[model samples]
Every structure is written in structure tokens, then in C-alpha cells.
Target chain A: MAAVKLLNCFVSPFGNRVRIALAKKGVEYEETAENMVTKGPLLLSSNPVHAKVPVLLVDGKAVCESLVILEFIDEAFAGTGAQLLPADAYARANARFWAAYVDAKMPECAGKIWKVPKGAPAVEEGKKEMVGVFKTLEGELGEKPYFGGEALGYADVALVTFTPWFLTYERLAGFSIAEECPKLTAWAARCVGENECVAKSLPDAEAVYQFVGGMRKHFGLE
Target chain B: MAAVKLLNCFVSPFGNRVRIALAKKGVEYEETAENMVTKGPLLLSSNPVHAKVPVLLVDGKAVCESLVILEFIDEAFAGTGAQLLPADAYARANARFWAAYVDAKMPECAGKIWKVPKGAPAVEEGKKEMVGVFKTLEGELGEKPYFGGEALGYADVALVTFTPWFLTYERLAGFSIAEECPKLTAWAARCVGENECVAKSLPDAEAVYQFVGGMRKHFGLE
Candidate 1:
């Protein structure tokens, strides 16, 4: 096997996506934690365009972008442990669609909770939008144990990384995700409890809350 | 082979992305052009979530999102005509990265030109941002004939859909893309000349210009 290394930031849900994927595949690799505040030379050179973390370095070559890197891992390590995406073409496309949906909707909706004043109209609007997004996702999840249906697959991996942030979001936004989307919340707990990869990789929710709280202060939001 | 159908809007570059990919694969399919002003039942039913164009229906199953549809076409029709994405994992990841970059940057930057006032400082700022994006893409292209290096591939298919709009953008923004990123501009011209799929699928630049002009007028910009 070619030597593998992952450049990641501890607090990033994007980085955790890679970590969980790697763990699921049972791939042994070195991980280097990066200081997002003061970016180092390796990160700058590896991801010159995005300058973002969760870059998977294979031997000497670098693969940037978490989703792209996830696809690469699945493709390159096809014969290894677990399959991240589905084998069926249509199913894989479905998984990709939902994963992309999570990416597109999460940041903007979640950012408002931490970035905006609590009493602001934008925060309330953001909460409404976030609920709508979660509701759509819940509909997609339907009766399936996982978004991939029976297995903790692509969409599961893509979304479970955000589970830790639920607490932070609930605390800041003043609404229970469990109250609004019980099935989705239950699915998240199932992932954390049942999946070894998810269990090992997810950080403490309280830690994430503290981290995000510090971030709000740093940005002069609190 | 399953019956394939594409629901699209004529003016959407996203729909055009799926169109070009299907054309490249030499797949015979039915296409229905939707009315953007009042979306029809099929469009609404097929993609209930986003309610957007570029829905690929295969054997009555709908695949929404243009990028996902492109990947589906590539995977489902593998070993048919031209390969949309590269076979090599690393190369495919690179193609995906740039295709995603185009998706992320194009809407905001290109959108400003048409959405904002003709002589607004924001339009100029948008132009500058667009040039920067093109320069980064140009650097990615380097001296290669295509983004896929030797052949028209995923990134090429993803981006060439926007070529018709370049003339409209240039005319609207009062800037020359050819002057700003000559290599990328030349590459676009090369794609139109060499690729039958692109040549046949791309609408005329003048027609796009007229369409956009009408759209601006509809919005009371002109």
C-alpha cells in the first residue's frame, strides 16, 4: 500500500468525514492536525486553491476537498474493508445527490446560529431553513436504517459528521433537533452507537459546543 | 438498455451540462424543455425537492442534480462512447475538483453581471473575481489541450456548457475573457471545434446573448 497521510483540523466536520471514512475502510494512516488560524506550508502547498483541511496525501501526491477525497478513497481502496458508496450506479448517484445536499445546506443554515446575534431575525430565519432542510432529509431517510439503506454508506458518512454539531446548534438556536426530527435524530444516535468508525471518530458534543462558543467570541459574535 | 429521458430548461447551463455529457456518451434519449416561468407537473413531480431542471429519468426512476446526472451517465454507460470522467482515481478526483470549483464559483461571479446594474462597482468587482477564478482554472489547465489532459472529459463537459454564455457575459460586463485568460479562452474554442458533442449541443453565442438581453429587459434592467 502506498503511504497515506491526512491533514486535518480537529474541530472540522469536513475533516471528520475523511477520518470516519478511513476508519471504516480499516486503512492505517498518519494524521497531522493543522492550526486553521495559522496555516502551515504543507497545507498551503497541498491545497493551494482551497487552502482547506481534510487533504489526503497518498505517498507524495495530495488530494484536496473532502468529498472528492472520499470518492478517491473508495475508488483507490476498492478491494479493502468497507465500501463507502453503493455498488449500483443509480444508488451511488442518489448517495452523491444527498451528500452534496448536506454540503450545500448545512454551512449556511448552521452558521447563523453561531455567527449571528441570538435575537436577530436572521437567526430565526436560519433556524426555519435548517428545520426545512432536516425535514427533507428525514423524508429521504424515511424508514431506512441508513440513507444508503441497511448499511452505513455514503450519505450516512457524509451526515454523521454533523451529528456532534447538533448539540451546539440546539444550544445556540434554542430548539431541539430531536423534537423536530425524531427519526433523523434517532438515526444519528444509531450511527454513533452501532458504527465503530463513527463512534471512534466523532468528537464530544460538549467539546464542539465549547469550541464553537470560543469561535463566536473570536469573531466578536458573543 | 433502459429508456432515458432528460427534463431541462433551455437557458440553464446546468441542464446543458447533462445534455453535453449524454451527447458525449452517444446515448439516445428523449428531452423535454420546461417552461421556467411556470414549471410543469413532470418537472415538479420528478424533482420535488429542488424543483430544478436537468432531471435524468432512467426507466422511470428520476435522478436530480446535473453533476449527479453526469456521473450517472458516465457510470451507467461505461465502455460505450467517450469516457466522461478519467479512469485513473487520482485523475478523476482532479477532474471532479475542478468541475466542483466551476459549480461553486460560476453562479455568484457570473450571476452578478446580469443581476446587478450595468455600471455598478459591484459588476466590476464581480468581473475581477471572475478573472481570478479563470486564472486559477487556467493554471489547472496549464498547457494541456483539455482539462482531462488528452481528451474531452468531465471537467470539460462540466464547463463547456457555459461557453455560449461567455459571449453574453463579455457583452454585459464590458470585459474580454479572451484577453484575461487567453489559454482558457483558446481551450474553450478548441472544445467547440473538436468535440462533436459540444459542437452540436452548445447553443449559438448570439442566441444566448439575445436571450440574456431579453432576461435583463424582463427584469427591467434594460
Candidate 2:
């Protein structure tokens, strides 16, 4: 077997996505925690273009980007635990569709709920935008137990990865995602409660909220 | 064999990307030209999240997003004429890195070069911003004959997809990419001249320039 290793930071939701995948797949691997604050030379050499983390090194080959890393992990460990994706072509495309949707749209919405200054115009606009996004997810869920149906597939993993951020943002923005998106809210709660892999990988809700709060203070927005 | 269908528009660079990919792979598919001004129900229902076109439907299943569809085509038809990506994990990640970089950065740069009002402050700022992005691409390219080196890959495809727009922008903006980033300019020339798929897929230089002129007039900026 090729030696598997993961380089990550604790706070990045993208990093957390890969960590959960590793744990969910029951794949044993070495890990190196990178200090994103002052990224080192080795890190720069490994990923020259972006130089960001959540880099998965498999047998000395480095793969950057969380979505790409997730695909690599699924392909590398084909028959481990639960199948991260469906085997069917169209089903796999739909799973990827949601994953891309989350990566492209939801993350930006989460950013709005996080970094925007309190009472800033962006904050209000972001709030409206995020609400709209959450409502769409609610419609997609539409009483289904999960985004990709009963079993938690790739889409669930993508959404669940960032759902924790909602709690943090809710405290800061003085609003709740649950109140706006009930089906999505219930689905998120179920994910946190049931997925041990995801549960272990996430930081405490209060800790995350405090972290965002500290960031706001540092930027003189609080 | 599954039926392959592409829903696209004539001047949309994104839609052109999928068309290029399909042609490069030597896969036959039916084409449906969509009107972006007033999107129809087929385009809307096919991609409800972002009712955009350039959707590739394989066996009646819609795969939206040009890059995502490109990956699907590569994966589904692995042994076709040209592999859109590298098979190795690291190489594939690198390919994806540049593709993402182009997707994130190019539109803004192109917008500045095309959409910015002729004499506005924003136009001047857009020009500066475009020069900066080009310099970055030039530095990355260095002395490599191609972005992917040896053969054209996803990174090359990403840039090549926008080749028509670059020329159009040059004419409309009254500036030349060749002067700003000589290497990238030369790289593009090599791409369009040598690559059969790209050469056949793109419209002539004058046609693209006219397209940009039409877009500018449509937006009341020209």
C-alpha cells in the first residue's frame, strides 16, 4: 500500500471535510498539522499555485484542494467503509453537482455570515443571500432524510462540512439558520448526532463562535 | 451507447469549452443552442440551482457547469482521442489548480478588458487589474512551451477556451495581450494554431471582436 498522509489545519472547514472523509473511510494514515498563519517552505514547495492546506500526500504525491482530495481518497480506498460516492454515472454526477454547488455558492454565503462587519451593508446583503441559499437547500431536501436521499452520500458530506459554521455565524450575525431553513436544520442536527467521523472532527460550537468573535475584534469591527 | 447532447449558446465561452472537449474526444453529440436573454424551461429545469446553459446531457441526465462536465466526459470516456487530464494524482491536482485559477480570475480580467466603459475610472482600474493577472500567468508559464508542458491539458484548455475572448478584448480595449504578456500571447498562438480541437471550435478573430462590440452595445457601455 502507498503511504497515506494528510497535511491540514484544525479550523478550515475545507480541511475538516477531508479529515471526516479519512475517518469515515476507516483509512489509517499519518497526519501533519500545518500552521496556516505562517506557511512554511515545504508547504510552498508542495503546492506552489495556491500554497494552501488540506493537502493529502499519498505515497509522496501531494493533492491540494479539498474537493480534489476527497475524490483522491475515495479512489485510493475503493472498498473501505461506506462508499463516499455512488457507483452509477448519473448518480455520481448529481453528487458532484451538489458538492460543486456547496463549494461555489454556500461557502461564499458562509463567508458573508462570518467576515462581514456587523451592521455593514455587506452583512445585510449577505444575510439575505444566505437565506435564499438555505431556502433552496430546504426545497432540495424536501422531506428526504438527506440531500442525496436516505443514506448520507457526497452531497450530505459537502453540506454537513459547513453546517457547523451556521451556529457560529448565527451567534455573530444575531440570526439562526435553523429558523430560516427547518428541513436543512433538522438534517444538519441528524448529521452531527449520527456521523461519528464528522462528530469527532468538528470543533465545539462555542469555540468556533468565539474564534469568529475574536477575529471581528482584531479587525476592529466588534 | 448513451445519447450525448449539449445545450449551448454561440458566443458563450463556457459553452464553447464543452463543445471543444466533446470534439477533442471525438464523441458525437446533438447540439441545442439556448437563448441566454430569455432562458427556456429545459435549461431552467436542467439546472435549477443556477439556471445557466452549456449543460451536457448524457443519456438524458444533465451535468451542469463546464468544468464539472469536462471532468465527467474525461472519466466516462477514458480511452477516447485525448485525455482532458493527467491520470496521476499530483499531476491531476496541478491541472485542477490552474483550471480553478482561470475560472476565478479570468472573468474579472476579461470583464475589465471588455465590459469596462471606454473612458470611465473603472475601465482604467480594470486595465491595471487585467495587466496584473496577465503578468501572473506569464510568470507561471515562464519558459514552458505550454501550461501543461509537453502536451495540452486542462490548464491549457482553460486558457485556450478564453482565447477568442482575449482577441476580442484586445480589439475593443485598444490594447494587446501580446504586448502585456509576450509569453502568454505566444502560448495562445501556439495553442490555437496547433490544436485541432481548439482551432476548429473557435470562431474567427473578427467574429469574436464583433461579438464583444455587440455585448458592449447591449449593456449601453459602448
Highest TM-score, which number? Answer: 1
What is the lDDT of every predicted structure here?
Answer: 0.89, 0.79
User: Which parts of model 1 have CA positions greater than 4 angstroms off?
Assistant: none
**Candidate 1 lDDT, tens digit per residue, A1-222?**
889999997778899999998998988999998966779899999999989998999997999889999999999988887898988998999999999999999989988777886577778878899999999999999999999999899889888998899998888878999999999999999998899999999889999999888877876787
> In lDDT terms, which candidate is top?
1
Model 2 alpha-carbon miss at residue A115, Å: 1.5
Local error of candidate 2 at residue B149 (angstroms) = 4.1
Clashing residue pairs found in predicted model 2: none
User: Per-residue lDDT of A1-222 in model 2, one digit per residue for the tens?
Assistant: 678778877667888888889999988788777865678776787777678888887777788888878877777676788877887766677788788878888777767767777777666667788888778778878888887677777888877877667777677567877778877888988887878987888777777777777777877777
lDDT of 2: 0.79
TM-score (all chains, Cα) for each model: 0.98, 0.91
Against the true structure, candidate 1 reaches a TM-score of: 0.98
Output the worst ten-in-a-row residue range by lDDT, candidate 2 chain A.
Answer: A116-125
lDDT of 1: 0.89
TM-score (0 to 1) for chain B of model 2: 0.93
